[model samples]
Target: MVTPPSYESRQFERRPGIRPRQTLGRRLDAASRAALPAAIAVVLLLLLHAPLGLPAQPALLLGAELACVFYWSLFLPRVMPSPVVFVLGLLVDLLGTGPLGLSVVLLLIAHVAGIAWRQALMRQGALVIWLVFAGVAALCCLIEWLATMLLEWRLLPPGSAALQFGFALGEYLVLSGPFAWCMRVVARPHG
Candidate 1:
């Protein structure tokens, strides 16, 4: 013979005196996941401004921020919408002493390109992906240089832009691995 569990044992209910509490972590978890990508972009942007003894000043791969935007845009376009991209660009502009809207425009362009290339990038090899990124970075650096010169009304040295492009490519090479890992962890199905 088998014994059935009592009703009280199987049917526990909260009394009026008991109330649900929302911890900070729980509250944050309740937020939409869409913010995750933008948050990462902000963190990466902050790291760029931090005193890491790395040459962030004077155009030492300003593409760090762009890299973050491009990576997320390419992999998970839905999570990172245009408004988030716009905010990230504003953050970059505020973090450094540069033209305010320059990053906004550049990041928006990267976002668009990444979205357009997402399908192709899915089937490409690592080298091809890196080459595509190199092209995007170069375009960003060139635009940045041209904008700076246009704003200042002077012919800024081209060498600086060239150096920035090289450093951007290097930044992509170093950061892409970690970015990919983060994407897997964050974007995985929550089942």
Candidate 2:
């Protein structure tokens, strides 16, 4: 019996352990992978303003986005550009009744600080990373408090500003795991 010509085609060849190809619609391309961090930033920003009925929800979400921005900016600068950070910060300012341009400046500074310390952070352990984050969050909170005071022409209680710093640090700890996982697994467009 002669095999049909179609039967002898390359498609007939079977590779062991490899499944048939499927649609790539579910897979993100390199550009999309690079944009994932920024996309996450947007989502977190939106959630920041959501009325979740929880006290300090806004602070928590802001902390989350700040952590997201810092991590991606440090590890994947292309994924989290300065403009995206600026926009998120702007949104925070717009959505809240805080001082205008305050978050924008803080976020931009955080993004820059992450970039500036990227190389050094890359070689460090989790402790060092956490310490550096603590410093950055502290500086940002301090700036925010000072800016608010200057804009309002009076001293406001530092409690909330200090709370913001605390939230940022806590969120960073919570988010670092997922961030690492995404960089190692989900963001790999090549595979």
Candidate 3:
């Protein structure tokens, strides 16, 4: 009589000594992956706020922050937690000499918006993602402009915020590919 296949003989069975838990090196790798977003934020802030002469410095800094925040929030929200976002925004505010909490509020709103949009898109193509990012970036710029005007109690020049938004869109488009590739490597589940 034919007997049932033994568990050890099954094709899908795991090999001996191979566990679901990763080795020490892999665990360290995963840890670094998790910390990458925060590290990148710190580095970006440092570079932007450095004393080097740069054109449109404030706008460039804001654009970089927005791109980094949006990319991480959309793809790897867990890696880019709210607290990290808050701290990054706070750093930008302190560095850029903007009103306290302005960047924080803007970043938090962007993070939420990104999460919502990512859910809707569900890993859709890059074009759709970029289109949605444009809308979100525009909204973020508006909110920031309104907040600045309200806090400072003065009307700002027209088209300033638009300029910032344009810079931010440029940053987003340029950085998305590199960030996406990094996320693919870092966010992958390790065995």
Candidate 4:
């Protein structure tokens, strides 16, 4: 007759002499990964309050846009949670003129799209990534314009939307490389 192994014997045999030190190291690594999004959020909030203005510009570059896209793509499955996206959008709406809740809704849509397409973009190069950022930025602009018109019942002229979209596309393209590099640096495994 064949005898079954004891529960204690089986458990010990599955993982022998795995020290608590190894477990602690893993926990620390996980904590480090989890901290990244919070760090990004704090930095973004600081930037929101910073005086990094471009004089004589009607439409200025906001760090929030870059922060949103970068954090969403880099930490899609973890850090950039839906609530964060919605809150970020609401914060942007409060800071800007386009109707309240408009930015929040637009951001939520963009974040959803980013999450859906993340895997496909991950394998591409920087230039392709920049192109993706441009597309997303354009979509954000479109959504904002649509939401404003729908809520306020004032049709924003096509020219205005085009101008705004152009400016955002340029801004996102300019910032994409730096943001992607920063995310890569942060995601690197520490020795």
Candidate 5:
């Protein structure tokens, strides 16, 4: 007859609390992943306010913010949480000349829209994504304009808002490629 090992010897619970430690590279990777969203937001802010002599309207800036939030939310929702989105929008509001909470609300809406449509959108091609983004940008601009009008208690001209919308949509096309590349570099998982 062969002797069997004791229960205590075989039980993993009996061992010391020697959990597997992550390697330094893995730790750094996780830290970078966590910081990436804010970093991207900051970069977008810088680009939005860069002294390029181009007029940086609230709509255009929000569109840039939308690109960041939208890309991250679609690709890495776990990294771009609601709180992060809110903070980024708040920072944009503080840094730019926009109504307080305007960026916050619009960005949050864009973030949520990204999350909601991510699955369907991800399956589609690049052109479809841009089309969808155009629709979201339009809706966000409309809501922003309406909110400003309601809060200010004055009828702002629709022409300027419409112009902003067109500029924002155009700007998105100009910026989306770089934004997507950044998203890939930041959100890519490490082995």
Candidate 6:
């Protein structure tokens, strides 16, 4: 009769590390999954550029930025990545009359900041998320104002940047709960 393996032998058995093994099929699947959100963001950005004259006025630009931030940071941070963020910002810069790298830098900064804060924010609920979004919007507006001042050598009128920033803040405030709920729905582990 054979004896059972000892506990020490079982304990020493080689086990895989935390990282999943990469395979061609898995990589392709990930790429495929990522395409949908990226394409949606691009199409939405283009539609925003279409000049349909949404009665909200100049806040439209702020709305676009808010959507980008929410999509890239909170929604699909891993799939979209930094290069996509930079490119999106570049497109915004080109579409708007702003300084060349303004949007690019702003988007990058915001994305990185969001990732850095993500862990702590994840522990909180919808209200905290809304507050974080407001903080991010305010920071982005400040950065945009500084860029404009440095590049254009002029300050925006009192209500100018504030209005735009308020629009962004409001967008986030209005949508944060729904977006968070959707994120949970989409992120549920499937088999």
Candidate 2 residue-wise lDDT, 39-158, digit = tens: 777777777677778788866765777788888888877668788888888888888777888888888878998999998998999989889888988898899789878988998999
Structure candidate 4, residue pairs in collision: none
TM-score of each: 0.78, 0.81, 0.83, 0.66, 0.79, 0.72
Q: Which stretches of candidate 4 lie over 4 Å from their true place?
A: 1-58, 61-67, 74-76
Query: Per-residue alpha-carbon lDDT of model 3 for 62-95, expressed as tens digits?
Result: 7788889988988777788899999999988887
How would you encode candidate 6's per-residue C-alpha lDDT over 74-166 as one tens digit per residue?
A: 644665578887787888888877888888887777678767787787688867776777777788888777777877787767566787788
| Candidate 5 clashes between residue pairs 3 or more apart in a chain or in different chains | none
Candidate 3 global lDDT: 0.81
User: Lowest summed-lDDT stretch of 10 residues in model 1?
Assistant: 6-15
Clashes of 5: 0
Consecutive 10-residue window with the lowest summed lDDT within model 3: 5-14
Q: What's each prediction's clash count? A: 0, 0, 0, 0, 0, 0
Estimate, for each residue in 1-191, the C-alpha lDDT of model 5 and write its tens digit: 98675343367446677845689987888678767776877886887687767754445677778877877787667778899999998998888776899889988988998899988998998888888888888888898889889988999988767877787777678777876676666655331
Give per-model CA RMSD.
11.2, 10.5, 8.2, 8.4, 9.8, 9.0
> Quick one: ranking by lDDT, best first?
3, 2, 5, 1, 6, 4
Which segments of candidate 6 are over 4 A away from where they belong? 1-29, 56-58, 174-191
Q: Candidates sorted by TM-score, descending order?
A: 3, 2, 5, 1, 6, 4
Candidate 6, pairs of clashing residues: none
Using alpha carbons, what is the TM-score of model 2?
Answer: 0.81
lDDT of 6 at 32: 61
Q: Give the alpha carbon lDDT tens digit for every residue of 1-191 in model 4.
A: 98686443466567856545558878787677656654565465456456667452334433345435454554344557677767766766676666787666666766776778777877887667667766766776677668768888877786666776677666666555555564567643321
lDDT values for all models = 0.78, 0.80, 0.81, 0.60, 0.78, 0.66
Poorly placed runs, candidate 2 (over 4 Å) = 1-28, 189-191
